[model samples]
Target chain A: MEFIAGKYNYWIYVALMMIGFYAMIAKGNLIKKIIGMNVFQTAVFLFYISIAKVREGTAPILWDRTVLYDNPVPHVLILTAIVVSVSTTAVALALIILIYREFGTMEEDEILRIQKNGSAVPPGKPE
Target chain B: MIDFALLFFLVVCAVAAIQMRDLLSSIMLLGIYSFIMAVVWTRLNAVDVAFTEASVGAGITTILLIAALSRTRRMETKQCVPPANLLIYGTVILLTSAVLLYGTLDMPTYGDPGAPAHSHVAPRYLEKSYEEVGVPNVVTAVLASYRGYDTLGETTVIFGAGICVILLLRRKI
Candidate 1:
């Protein structure tokens, strides 16, 4: 049990990753897949934050006296990453909305059927 | 020991991602695989790389996959074919693994105090960073001052990617 406890954080990250991945792949709903993606990304963020930790270190600021400091490079890089992620998410969500408007349904199979039919019937109409 | 375990987990996630029947599940597994890869980068002491991987690999890439999947259909199990592309994929994997393993042989031993990376430039930065760059963090000095051009390029790449995505998704209006 000690061994398991020692590695508990790592294990949790892995489990969360798996659950997110499973949801993204197994679910037919598009929004559910985006949620899974968000979970997966958060797991990676957790991994980064865990590694940035230092034993008994303070912020990366200097004082009159020298003191141990946790590394701040990772934090800086992550800030940039967050901005990029938000931009990408905005674009992706916009595309998803467009797909819904065109197909009138988010189901992949149904959209493909309409595409294959070459506009014989407008979307969301009875056969 | 932990390193090996993490690597094993990464491999498992990658395999599961490739083998999954549903496209959505495969993309999700790919995100998990990316997260594990970020963990591996952190374990290797590349915290910056780990952060970028977490954000780009897990976050942005996953959203892109979800968007693509929403336009497509869930793949049917009966539509799956035998692994006829196995030989080509196996060869590519073998070549990549070989190249990476060979490159590792030339790398300095992990955490070697005498390595050039820790000796010449890094020590100078650590000792004189405050006086020279007026920054407490040597990494920031290196990134913002010494390698400013590279950082600018990276920012441009992000902007370009955003533009490409907009062009692909947006209508005439």
Candidate 2:
């Protein structure tokens, strides 16, 4: 019970991660896969933020001269990660649009079928 | 009380986003998931992280995804599920979870003051942030001053991504 009590947060995040992992691999639609990737990234952010928590600690502000502050490093690092995630999503969405324009579909299997059959809609040609 | 409720909400949103068939609904659920994660970060005293997550995760990401969805099909077409692929993914996920769980067993408790993470360079930043950078929010100070190069690189990467998107989607390409 003590083990469970102390580490439930990690366990929950891990489960959340698995959900995202399953979605990324098993989902048919490309957009759903992107959403899964976001969930996976968010789970990681939660894990890092959870690590930054301090017992009986306040937010990382220096208002009081003698107050315990949670670790600020993880918070700082996650900022960059969050920004990168947005950029990645933007790029991914743009690529998806291009894929749609070229193949007329976003379903993975359809895209593969079109590619395999090598129809007139050869991808990457400036349309 | 709020923690349990919020975590539960997060799980619901993540699962719903995964299982949702309509692309629009899935995108909305993911937005909600990001918003709830921001709230959870706040509850955990990571206000800055929460702020970033809210803006980037909940705000811009959802808009981008919606824009893409509008340009693409709304419903997923039928595709035959492959048991072999499922087995491969399942085996990989199970092995990863086991490894992660093993690593977690050695991690410091949720809020241990003496954890190595806290004892390392974190203390010096807390000790001298006001003097070195004179910023009230140590996170901002560290992010801007101590880690300025990383932030600059991050900005460059975002700028590059914007350029890539424009080149890929715009008529100019």
**Which predicted model would earn the best lDDT?**
2
Model 1 Cα lDDT, one tens digit per residue, B1-173: 79667766765675566557676787788788778777866664455656667777776777777766565445523232236544554455456445544544554433334545444544454556678889866557756776666567658767876786677566732
Assess candidate 2 and give its lDDT.
0.88
**Which CAPRI category fits model 1?**
incorrect
Interface RMSD of each: 8.4, 1.8
Candidates in order: C-alpha RMSD to true structure: 8.3, 2.4
Error of 1 at B43 (Å): 4.3
Residue A53, candidate 1: how far off, in angstroms?
Answer: 15
User: Residue by residue across A35-67, what tens digits does model 1's lDDT show?
Assistant: 555555555554444444444444444443455
Task: Tally clashes: model 1.
Answer: 5
| Predicted candidate 2 versus true structure: per-residue lDDT over B28-90, tens digit per residue | 999999999999999989999998899889999999998888777787766656999989989
**Which residue pairs collide in model 1, if any?**
A21-B28, A24-B24, A24-B25, A25-B24, A25-B25
lDDT of 2 by residue, A1-127 (tens): 7677568778878878988998888877788889999999889888999899988999998888799999999999999999988898898889888888887877888788888988747343433
lDDT (C-alpha, whole model) for all candidates:
0.57, 0.88
